[model samples]
Target: MTMEIGLNLFSVFKELNEDYFGTLEKVAEMGYKNLELITVNFSTCERYTDTFSLPVIMKKFEDLGLKAFSAHEGVAPGSVIIDADWDRIIEENAELGCQSIVFPMAFISGREDTLQTAEHLNLIGKKCKEAGLSFYYHNHAHEFRRIGETSLFDLLAENTDPSLVKFELDLVWVMRGGYDPLTLLEKLGERCDMVHQKDLGMHVNPVNLFTATPQGTNLDTMKIYTEFVKPNDFVNLGTGIVNFQETYQKLRQLGYIRYAIVENEGQLGIKFTSIESDLKVMEKYVQGL
Candidate 1:
C-alpha cells in the first residue's frame, strides 16, 4: 500500500497567525490532500470549537479538497491524558473526521515518568478506542534515553497494549536521539502507523528534559548557541543527512501505508521556500513509490 502525503499544520503556525483559512488554502494549493491538526493553545482550540463546529469544519475541508486525518493534542505530559474535557475534544475531532488522536510530546524525567506515561497512554488509548479513534504517542529525542539497558521508547512500546497504542515516529528526532530510524522501525513494526518526515543537518545533543530547551534552543535564540558553540538544527529534507529513498523503501517493506506527514520545525530558517521544496521532494518520493 502507498502512504499518503500530509502536512502537520504546525509547520506553518506562524503564517497561520496572519491568515488562518488562507494558510490552509495555500497548503491545499501546494498539493497536500491531508492535514494533521496541531492544538497549542485555547484560542487555537476554540478556532475549531467556538468558530466552527465539526460538520462546518468538515465542509470547509471538503471545499478545500483536504482531509483531516489526525490531530496532535496537549503539548506536555500533564495535559496529554483524557480528562473531563476529553468528550469535547473527542467529539470535535470526530466531527472533523480525524481517526487518530496523538499526544505530541511528553516531558519525561526518568524511568518512573516513562512508565507513568505508558499507563496514561493506555488510559487515553482506551478512551480513544471507546470513542472510535486511535491513540498514538509522538516521540522526541528524550524517549531514546536508556532506562537500564532498554530505551524508554522500547519500554513504552513493550508495556502498552499494541491494539490500544501506536506511535507516530519522528524520524528526525530519532536521529537526534542517536538511534537508527530504521532500527527503531524494525522494533516497533506494525505498532507504527504514522511518520513525521524531517531531516537533521548535524548531530544535536540529546535533549535535557529538565532544562530550558527541551526541543533544542528555539530558532530565535539559536544565535546564542552559535556565539558560544555551533548548534545542530533541523534542515530541509533531501538537503540534510536523512536518506528518504531508503526510509521509504523500508516503510513499504514494513507495510506502513498510513500517513507520512511532512514536518519542519525549522521553517523559520528558510521561511516557506524550504517547506515548499521539501514538500516537492516528498511528492517526488511518493510518486516513485
Candidate 2:
C-alpha cells in the first residue's frame, strides 16, 4: 500500500490567522487526510492552549473527515510536562481518536538533557498507552546534537520503551544537522512513525541549524530557482531541494507506511501561496505513491 501523506498544521498557523475554523476548512480544501494540531497562537483564552481543551475543534476535524492522528504541545512552561492538563490531553486525544501525541523540544537545554527527555516521554507514553495512545518526539536538527558517543535521538530511543515512545521525524532539520537522514531513520527503527518533509535548494552560506539558514542567504524571503535543498534550505515540496522520489523509495524500503507531514514551518512569513504551491506539486507525487 502507498504511504499516507498529511499536512502539519503549523503552516496554517500563519496564514489562517490563528483562526481554527479557517485552518480546518483550508486543510479539508487541500485534501489532506491527516493533521497534527499545534500549540495555538490565538489570543482567545481557550484557543491559546499548550493545554488542550478543544472538543469543538476536534469534532470539526471529525466532521470534515480529517483524521487528527497526532498533535504537538510544549513541555509545560517551567515544568517538564503539563502537570495540570496532562490527563486532559490523553483523554481528549483518545476522544478525538488520535493515535499519538507529539512533544516538541523548545531549547538546546531541553534537547541536551537526554535522561530527562526520555523519562518525560516514557512516563507520558505509559500513561497514554493505557488510553490507547502513543507518545513521541517531533525531531528538529537540535535533537541530533552529540554529547559523547551518541546523539540525543540515540539516547532517548535507547532509554524509552520501544513499545511506547515513537518519533515524528523532521527530514529537513535532520539533513541540516549534517547526519544522513536515512541513518537516523535506520537507527530509529519502529520508533519512526511520522515525518516532516519539505525541500530546500542548495543554501549558499555557512549553515545555521537553529535558524535553518545559510550564509549569504536572506532566509526571511528566499527566492527559489534550483532544486538542491541545502542544509537549512527548506521550501515547499517541488520548489526547493529535497528529492522526494528517493526519499519515498527509502521510506517504502524501510516499511514507513504512515503519515508524511509537510511541515512548512513559517520560514519567512505565513503565506498560503506556499501551501498552495506545495499542494499543486505534491498532489502528483502523492497520487503516484
Candidate 3:
C-alpha cells in the first residue's frame, strides 16, 4: 500500500530549456525517483530534449536514477488525436521506457464531445495496451461542467472501457471543479492508478470555479476563465487548504495507486524552493505509507 513520490517535470518546465541536464540533476538530487515528462510541441511530438535522440535521453535518465514513468501528450496542433499515427507514437514511448501514455488535457463542449473524446481515448488505450503500455487521461476543471445532470467527466468515464482507458486524477482540479477530491477518487476506484498532487490555496477566489461561472457554461468558455487565473492563486502544499495527508492516506488504503506526482504550475521561477517544500510536506503527510 506504499506509494512512491515523484515530480511532474512541468514544475520546472522552463528551467529545462535553459539547462536540461542540470535541471534534471537538481530534481534527482532533490530525491525524486520518477518523472512525468512534458511534451514541448505536440506538432512534431517534441519533448524536453528535442535535439537528442530517445536513446540519449534514456541514458541521461539512467545516469540520473530517474524513471520516465509517464508523459503528457498535450492538445495542440497535430497532437495525438484519434487519427494520429498510433504505431509510431507507441513505438517511440515504449522505446523511451515509459510505463504509460497520458493525455494531459482535453477540451469538450458537451456530452457528444465528451463521449467522442472517450472513444478517442479508448482507441488510444487499446493501442497502448497492445504495445504493453497503459493509457490514461488527466483531468482539469472543465470536465466537471455539466451535460444535464451528470458532469462531462462522469459521462466520459461511463462511456470509456475501464480496462482500456484509465485515469490519472488531479486532486486540485477535482476541488476546483466543485467535487470533493476524496469522493471523486472513491468513484474512480481502480480506474485511477496515479494522481497529480497540487495544493489549493486558501485565498484562491471562488474556490469552486463552477460556482462563479454560469451553471450551464460549456467547457470551451470555461477554459477562458481558467486562463485568466492568477499565478499567485497557487501556494505551497501545506500552506494551502488541501488536505494532502488525508488524501494520500486514503489512496494508500485503496491499495492500487503507486505514484503520487507533485505538479506545480504557473509557480515556477525563483520558486524552485517551493517545489522542494511541497515534496517535504508530502513526505510528512504520507509518513506511514
lDDT of 1 at 148: 62
Best by lDDT: 3
lDDT of 3 by residue, 59-135 (tens): 99999899988887656533437866567767877888889988887777578777888989988999999999999
**Model 2 lDDT per residue over 255-282, tens place:** 8547777777536534566776776666
Top-down lDDT ranking: 3, 1, 2
Query: Candidate 3, residue 24: CA error in Å?
Result: 0.6
Candidate 3: clashing pairs of residues: none
Q: Quote the lDDT for 150 in model 2.
A: 70
Off by over 4 Å in 3: 41-45, 77-80, 214-219, 222-228, 266-269
Error of 1 at 187 (Å): 1.3
Model 1, 1-289: lDDT tens digits are: 6788888988887776566677788888777888999644334544445654566667778999998899988743355454536667777788788999988877764678778889988988888899999999998766776656877788888888999999999987776555888888888887887999977664544434213344443322222244422333667888777788888888878886587889987734644676778788888786672
The Cα error of candidate 3 at residue 253, in Å, is 1.8
Off by over 4 Å in 2: 42-55, 76-78, 82-84, 106-112, 204-233, 267-270
lDDT (C-alpha) at residue 57 in model 1: 63
